[model samples]
Each structure stands twice: as C-alpha cells, then as structure tokens.
Target: NESVWTADQNEEMSNTSASPDSVSLADVSAEKATQGSDTDLEVEDPEKAFAGVMGAELYLEACRLTEVVPVSHFIQNLSKPYVNLNHHGLGPKGVKAIAIALVSNGTITHLELEDNCILAEGAIYIAEMLRENSSLQELNISNNHLDTAGAEAIASLLLDNMSYLHALQLSGGLYALKQSHCVCTFVSLQGNYQVKELDLSHNGFSEKGGQLLGQMLARNTTLEILDLSWNHLSRKGTVALGTGLRGNGALKILNLSWNGIGNEGALALGEALKVNNVLVHLDISNNQINNEGAKNLCRGLEVNGKLKILKMANNPLTVEGATALLASVRKNHNCMMEEINISNVLVNETFIKLLDLVCRMRPELDVIHGEVEGCITKIPKQHPNPMKVIQKYLKEHNLQLWDFFRNIDKDGNMKIPVAAFRRAMMQQQNIPLDRVQIGELVRQLDRHRTGIVDY
Candidate 1:
C-alpha cells in the first residue's frame, strides 16, 4: 500500500511538471539524449517542448563539445533554438542542407560551421543563406578545404547578405587570396558593415591579397580586429597593407604572425603605427623580425600612443630584441604596453636578470616568460634515465601536470577546473578552451586520465 502511494505521489509529481519531449534542451545534450532511456509521456505544453528542443544551452554545448553529429536527426529535431551549429566533421552537402533548412525555417542565428568538408558549392549555399537569412549574425566557416570558388562565394555573400555578420573567420587554407589567377578579392567592402572582427589567418595570401584587403580598408569602416597569420605576406604585402593603415581610425588588432614579415615589412608596419592610433594589439610573432625589426618596432612604440599589446614570440629576436622592448618600456612613464610574449627567442642570463629587474621596478606590466624552469616539477639530472624517460613521456602526453577536474558546484563533468594555476598553465601551453585541454591534435581535447596521486 505504501509503495503504491509512493508511486502515485511520484507520478503526480512528474505529471505536474514538464515532460521529456517538453524538457528544456537548454541544459540537455545529445549525449544525454543518446544516453537516456526514458520513454514515458508526461503532461507538457507544445511551446515549452519546442523551447526545450531549441534552447541555447543544449545546442551550444552539443556544437562545442561534440565535433560530430548525425546529420539527419540534427536537422530535423535539434537545430531549432540554437545560434551556433559547429558540426565539424559533417560534409559540405550535409552542412548546406542543414543551413538551407534552418534558413527556410527562419530561426537560426550565429552559425559557426568551422572545420568541416565544406567546399565551393557548399560555400555558395551558405552564401545564399547569408543573402536571404537576415537573422543570422555571425558566420565562421574556417578550417575547411575551400578554393577560389568558395572564396568568391563568400565574397558574393559579403557583397549581398553579409552586413549583419559582425565576426567572420575563414582561416585554414580556403585558398590563396593573392594568386594572380584568382578572381575574388580577399573580401570586398561593398556591403560589409564595420564588422568588429575578421580572421583570415592561415590562408595562402601574399602581396596581392594584402594589397586587395588594404584597398578595401582605405574606404571600409568598422573592422577592428584582423588576423592574417600564417599567410605568406612578404615585405611587399606588408608595405601594401601599411598604405591602408596610414589614416585608418577604427581598426585595432592586426595579427601577421608566421607571415615572414622581415625587417623591411616590420618597418612599414611600424611607420604606419606612427600615424595610426587605433590599433591596440599587434601580433608579428613567428616572423623573421630580427633585432633590426625589433628596433624598428620600438621606434614605432616611442612615437605611437595607442598600441598596447605586442606579441613577437617565436621570432629570431635575440637578446638585442629584448633589450629594444625593455628600453621602450623604460622610457614610457605611463607604459600603455601591458603585455609582451617573448617565450623562445633565446634570452641569456643577462637579459633574464634585466627583465627581472624591470618587472621589479615597474610591477605593473606582466611580461610572460613561457620558458619552462622548475615550474611544474624539477627534472633532476641525477635521476635514473628510465624514470626520466617515463616522466618525459608523461609530459609529452600532457598527463603529467594534472588531470581533468570537474566543478562540484556547476556541471559534474570531467573538465579543466577554473583555477588560477590551471589557467596560467593553459596560457603558457597555448591551450584556448575554457574547460578542456588542447590535446595533440587540433580541436581534440585531452581525455586521458592523468595518473597523479592526489595528497
């Protein structure tokens, strides 16, 4: 009798609230949907059920965590209320189909279909969606194997349906932006609104692409951040880009990392900065910015007042380059330059000691020296080579420092806990995820159990 009463009470409680189909997808995930086994129908409104199905939390988590989702189920049921849809491994046809469906429905906003098999025709479909779908805000189709046709499709979308897009990331070898034979200019400014950020990094763009983008910038208004990293923008390209920056007012962050911008290119950027005052962050890392280039940058810093954060890491900046930055910092009383990432440029004891002194003197600027010392655990010289060998293996595998610790207060999942130490470690290692660690491969989070005994 008591068990029956309890069952009745439980059923009453369950019926009074929402049902599974009516459950808020804002918190639920595809993993949960796949894992759950409940089939009982409960009393719930259709509106609530739809809200739950298309909630922001559920779709975002699904998009962010799982790189692969079944194309059919996702299009039919899942993509109702979500903004970002990052079905990474889904092929171009699948993505285009999904986008077409969403645009037809007129609900999706902020689509991010990065790291997929999307190419030319697929890009055109997305372009069509952009032109017609006025609700979508941001589009990131980066890391896809797209060519000139795809670029032209995107460019067409920019000219027609891409004004609302505040952020666009088309990085990772879509095509060469500067090839002589290519028809599409990097991105035309005909209808592009003053987009806040644009990342064309890692695309094969040389002098021609740089010059094309420069021409767009001369008249275009509103883009603040531009990332052209990993492109082969030689000295000629940099000089051409400088022409656009000479009198620019709204642009701020410019990333030319890994572009091989030698001293001459660096000099051009520096000269542009002398007059351009809006740019705050500049990343010239991984270039051949030798001591001469560093000196030129320092000269620009002296005259310029707006530039703040400078990242020259992984360049050929010897101790002399460090000295140049240190000298510039010493001169400015109100040192606007808050951060300088000089990790592996080979700074000797003298430079290190001088850096220590500079930090001790100012105590305001946080100069990050990413070189490993006894920070994690001391790798003793006298230890057995076998144990050392094991340790090296663990460190290389990223299971040495710590394990994935989840939050007790929030979601009870194995993720990188938000701790000061963990955040610092991630920054040093260049890991970008808020709750996951960057494993060996791109978009692959480290999931191996870190074999460390907790005290």
Candidate 2:
C-alpha cells in the first residue's frame, strides 16, 4: 500500500530574484546536504534554540544545495523535525526554517503549511525541492496565495517529478472555483503516476480544472482517491468527470462535495456508478441535489451494489429524498453499507421510520439521525424538538457534548438541513463520515450549530 518513488529535479535557474517586498527566510547552501554527522545525531544536552538551528543545518545538507550561502532563499540551517515548529510567533523565517527542514527531513511524510503566508518565491523554492525529494508523501500548502505563476511552478515540478507522494492537499489556495477560470490550465497530474490521494478542495479551479484533472485520471492508473470538494464544480464539471470515470478503473474513492452539483450531475455520476464497479465510496453532500437528484442516485444504488458508502446528507434532499434513498438501500441486498449519515436534512417521521426499520432489519447497519426531530418538525411530522430529544439522548447515553455536536453541519444559515444534520449524527453514532463528506457538510451549516450536539 505504501511505496516510495523518485526523480531528479529539472529546471532552468532564472536570474529572477524574489521581490524585495517579499518576506525572506534564510537561504539554502549550495552543497549536497547531509544528515547531522554521526556524532551530532546524538547529544547528551541539547538546547532548544540550538536544536532548532541544528535541525535547519541538517536539512540543507540532506537536500544537497546547488547554490552558495545567502542564495536568495529561505532557512540557512536545520535540526528539528520540520513539522514540530507549528508554535505561536513563528514568522516567515520560522516558517521558512520549517520548510527547509521539511524539504530534507527523511522521517516526515506529511507537511501542512497551509495559511502560513508563503508567497510565490517561497512556493517556488519548496516546489524546486519537492521536484527531487522522494520521502515526503503529502504536502498541504493551501491558503498561501499561490497565484498562477506560483501554481505553475509547482505544476511544472509535478509534470516531471517521480515523487513518492500519493496524496497532495492544496485546498483553499489562490485558485477560487470561478476565479481560476482564466488561470492557465497548465496544472498536470500526468507525472504523478503513483499518487493515490489528491485533495484540491476550496481551490478556485472550477469546471475547467476539474475537466483537466478528470481527463488526467482517465489516463493515470494508480490513483484511487480524489477529493475535489468545495470547488463549486457544477453539473458541467460533474458530467466531464463522469465521462472519465466510465473508463477509469483504479479509483475507489471520489469526493465532489459542495460543488453545487444538482440532479443532473448526480444523474451523470449515478449512471457511471451503475457501470463502474471499482469505486467503493462516494461523497456528494452539500450540493444542489434535491429529491429528484436523490432518486437518481438511489437508482444507481439499487443497481450498483459495489458502493459501500453513499453520502447525500446535504444538498437539497428533503423527506422525499431521504425516503427515496432508503428505498434503494432496502431493495439492494448487496449494498455492504455499514453506516449512514443523514443529519439536518429535514428528515421527518417518514424518513426516520424507514431508517429505523432498516436498522432493525440490518443489525450491522449504523444510522445517524442528527436533528431528525428538527427536520421532522419542519414539515409538521410527529416529533419533539430535535435539540431537546438529542440532549436527552446524550444525557441518557453518557455522551459528551463535544462528541455529540462534532457531527452537526456548522455551516448552515438556517436550522437542520441534510448535510449538517447527517455529519453530526455520524459523530454521535461513532461512525466515520468520510473526511470529504464532513468537509462539505461543515460548509453548508450555520456556524452556531457546530460543536454542540452530542450523542
């Protein structure tokens, strides 16, 4: 399941100097970087500050610097684990110091530098390093304002590098779904043959980028997980991706949450699911799907028994939609689903009764009814106040408030909707809502509803 791949870095050295206004971290050395000497690896008494610098120095040596000191770059020395510097008061230098450590650290597999205020230059420096490094597996540099130029720099590296990374998380980067339409469609995943997990959630890469990536997935053979959550991929984008899935066989997990995909998109994906058997998990929460979309997906669920998890908690699913989905689940005996999250979806007595019956029939299935009472209340269904009922249940079950509320969609403007309600239900039920499912539902619920519901 885990493997390491490698390649040499290839790029022309531009005389291009980073902007003076840009925040500068220490620079890398122009030598084949090495780990601390065998002697330095062990120390009886190591000072905290000195340990940080030593870690920095070791980073430079390990990366094999090609430039001299003061090379118009970041960190000059390294010693500590790159990820441990996530403390308060870490400035650009501190950040750069950490990145330097990451670029060379052999033990670190995941580096999350999202929202660290890293600019194009910093990104370029790291991009150059990542092009050659093989140990790091997951890199998250999202929300750092990487424009097209910055994005392109990393893309260029990805276009050539034989990296060991199977997962790359760059959500909420400079690309905004609608805004990134004009950006050059140069981002490529063709070279990342071994990558299995990719999260481009909240980046502005709209349908165009989605299409590009979908096409890439069709040709690439190793990827099994792709998360395009929160990129506002509409029906057009969903259609484009569905076309790719028709032929792709390696993918097992696909997350397209919060993309405003309506019934049309759901239908397209459902059609693909009917024919494609490899995918095991699909998250389509917090989109524009309503009862009609749910019915389409339900049709697929009835016919496609391979999917073990189907998330449609959010979007516009109502009582009708929930019943539709439940009907499909009940009809499909081959559905190996062990969990279902239907939080905040206006789940009335109709849906709740059906779900309870399903649970009774299938003892192995776990069902979450986050705010089921509240959803029921919306349509004059028979139920007490959802919040009160939930509170009482938690009290009876000895569930903590945090655990109860962790699943509620904290992103909605109004009360319980499907997505928010679904996730909260999952948290309380102790079922794992796919990360992408939670991410999408979280964005659709009101903030006030977050972190309060319990078992």
Candidate 3:
C-alpha cells in the first residue's frame, strides 16, 4: 500500500476532529490506490510523519487522559534534543503524563528532571516509558524521592537488551530519606553492558551499601566512570571496594573523595593498584590519609604503569610522605603518571629536592604541594619517643609509672588490652601524645602483635 500525503493534506488531517472509526477499510484502500505508486512512496521523507504530529498536541492529549496539568514549557522544549525540566515540581501524576507523551517520541535524546519531588511512583512511570522508548541516551533524575522500589525498577531497565541509556545520575535524595541502601539495586549493573557512566554521590552509603557496590564493580565490564563522592564509606567499606578494584579491568575514572577512608583503606587500595593496570584517573582527596597511608600507596605506585592522574589534596600529609610519593614515581620506569595533587601538605627542602629530581627524570610529571615550611640545613628533629614523653608527663604530675600501670591493669594481671592502654593515655591530657605517637607506643610495647600489651 502507498499513501503520499502533501503538506496541505497533512495539515488538514492534523486539524480534523474525526475519529478513526469514521474512515472505513475500503475508503482507506481506495485513497491509498489514488494517492501514489509504491515507487513514489519509497522516496518519501521518513520524518514527515513525526513533524506533522506536534509534540504539544501529544502532550496535551496525555495530560487530558491523566487529569494532570500540562507544562507549557515542557511541550515547547519537547522538540529539542535535550529537555531540562529540573525543579519544575512535576510530581508523580505530572511525570506520568510526560512519560506517556514521550513514549512514542523520537526527538529527545537527553532528559533532566532533577528536584521535581517525583517519588517512587514517578520513577516507576519513567521506568515503564524507558522500557518502550529507545531514543534517550542520558537521563538525570537526581534529587527525586526514589525509594528502594523505585531505584530497583530503574536498575531493572538496564538489564533489558533494548535499553540505550549510557549515563544515569541518581544522587541526592536517597540519603536524606535514610534509604541509602536503595543503591543496592546498582548490583544489577553487574550484568548490564550498556551503561558507561554512573553517579551515586551524596548517597550516604553505609558499610553494607559499599559491600553491595563492591560486588557490582567486581563483575561489571562496561562501566568506565563512577562517582561515589560525599558519602560515608569508612575504613571497612573502603577496604571492601578496594578488593573489588583488584579484579576490575574496565573502570577508567573513579572518585572517592570525602569518604573518610583512613590508612587501613589506603593499604587495601595499594594492594589493588599492584594488580590493576586499567584505571587512569583516581580522586581520593580529603580522605584523612596521613603519612603511613601515603607510604602504603607509594608501594603500589612503584610498580603500576597505567595510572595517569592521582589527586590526594587536603589530606594530612607531611614532608616525609610527600617525598616518598615522589621517590616512588622516580623508581617506576614504566609509570605513566602525569599529575600528583597534594595541595594542602606543607613541604620542606628535602621534599622539594626530591620532587625536583623526580621531575627532571620524568619531565611530564606535575606534582602539586603547599609552600615550603623551611630548608633543612642540618639533621632534622627526630620524633620524641612515646616512652620518654610518657615518663616526663608522669614526673610532672608526681605520679609513679608503676601506679599508672596498676590502675590500668584493674584485674591484677600484668597484661591489659591495647584499647584500654590507649584510652588511659588519652584521658591524661598532660601526656602530650598524638595519635601517631600513641600508635607507636602500642607497637613498641606489644612487639608480638597480640591485642594486649604487657604493662
């Protein structure tokens, strides 16, 4: 069958209120036969049909059917390839109408509906629409009140073979609702092969949520960039994620800033870096990593070759840690690292000299550090021994060291848990021992690695 409708004829048909029942099958056959030949129809413009069905008309019809107010701005922007209706207050009913209108749409490729108060129901409606539509490539629904069910529905869409989504942003609302575990649905991405970029920042993911994400990263192969910033992934969670990174081969850029992953987490990541060679950019700034963590990371940097950018700014690092990192870069002949950011750490002359040497060796490398404190012309001041510091504190307080140990050892046994020893040291404000010094004291007193120290 061949039907060639002119512009005028198409306009007339769009203006008409006639229902399909008004035209019989015989009438349609006769019109098709009189309009044009099959050869003529083969040359017709494919977009003609889409142009004639106005987006505004389709949206209005959907609004009427759903009993929701139609957004005039949304209708005006529907013809655009990227439609941003962020903060438009489109609740469940409003989004349902838009979803219906967009089901058959072929023009829009990107959609942003952030901060619209669209809850789980709205997310379900969007998931249903995506199941039938294949034109959208990017979707940002951040700040919507999507609970566990809603998140699962959206994640399930990724498993469909026909879905074309490449980038999805679902940050900012789950945390406020105390439903951070909703991110567990992302584990479905383990079987997905289309999504390349995912943003789950500000979700306040707990240790369990981190464990679930680790499971996903361990198996997903198509994901290239992931953003997990501004969450609460402490040491245990971070350690779990690092274990996943050891096996991942496709991730290129990862953001774990502001997650408070301390030295133990840094050690786990160092182990991962020793085996992973695909990651190119890493951001672990503001993670509370100190000298010990920096040294642990350097161990990995000395052997890895694929990483290019390392950002560790705003961390509590000193000259010794900074020097170690630079020296590691110099040792790795195959290292492709180009930039290392430690912006807030103050460096001394020794660190500066080492950085200069590393730069001379690899002219392309850029290291960002804070201003130099001072030049070290003589031997640097050694750290005060924890034992000596404790003795001095006891002498000033007129307290005997044996009495202090007896008080700590309440059970009359010579041994006391390391935690109790640390607590006793912390309570004496005059002890003047920082956490690092306290750790050193524990190490020196408990030489056997036992949980208890012999008082």
TM-scores of the candidates are 0.62, 0.63, 0.69
Stretches of candidate 1 off by over 4 Å are 1-73, 76-92, 104-107, 161-163, 177-191, 348-362, 370-455
Q: Could you say which candidate leads in TM-score? A: 3
Ranking by TM-score: 3, 2, 1
- For lDDT, candidate 2 versus 3, the one ahead is 3
**Residue pairs clashing, model 1:** 25-52, 54-81, 194-222
Which of 1 and 3 is ahead in TM-score? 3
Best by lDDT: 3
Q: Tens digit of lDDT per residue, candidate 1, span 36-106?
A: 22211111343443344433343343332222233433544444545444544555444543553444345
Candidate 2, 244-265: lDDT as tens digits: 8877889899988888879998
Model 2 C-alpha lDDT versus the unseen true structure: 0.58
lDDT score, candidate 3: 0.75
lDDT of 3 at 448: 92
Kindly report which residue stretches of model 2 are placed more than 4 angstroms away from their true locations once superposed: 1-55, 58-104, 176-191, 348-353, 370-455
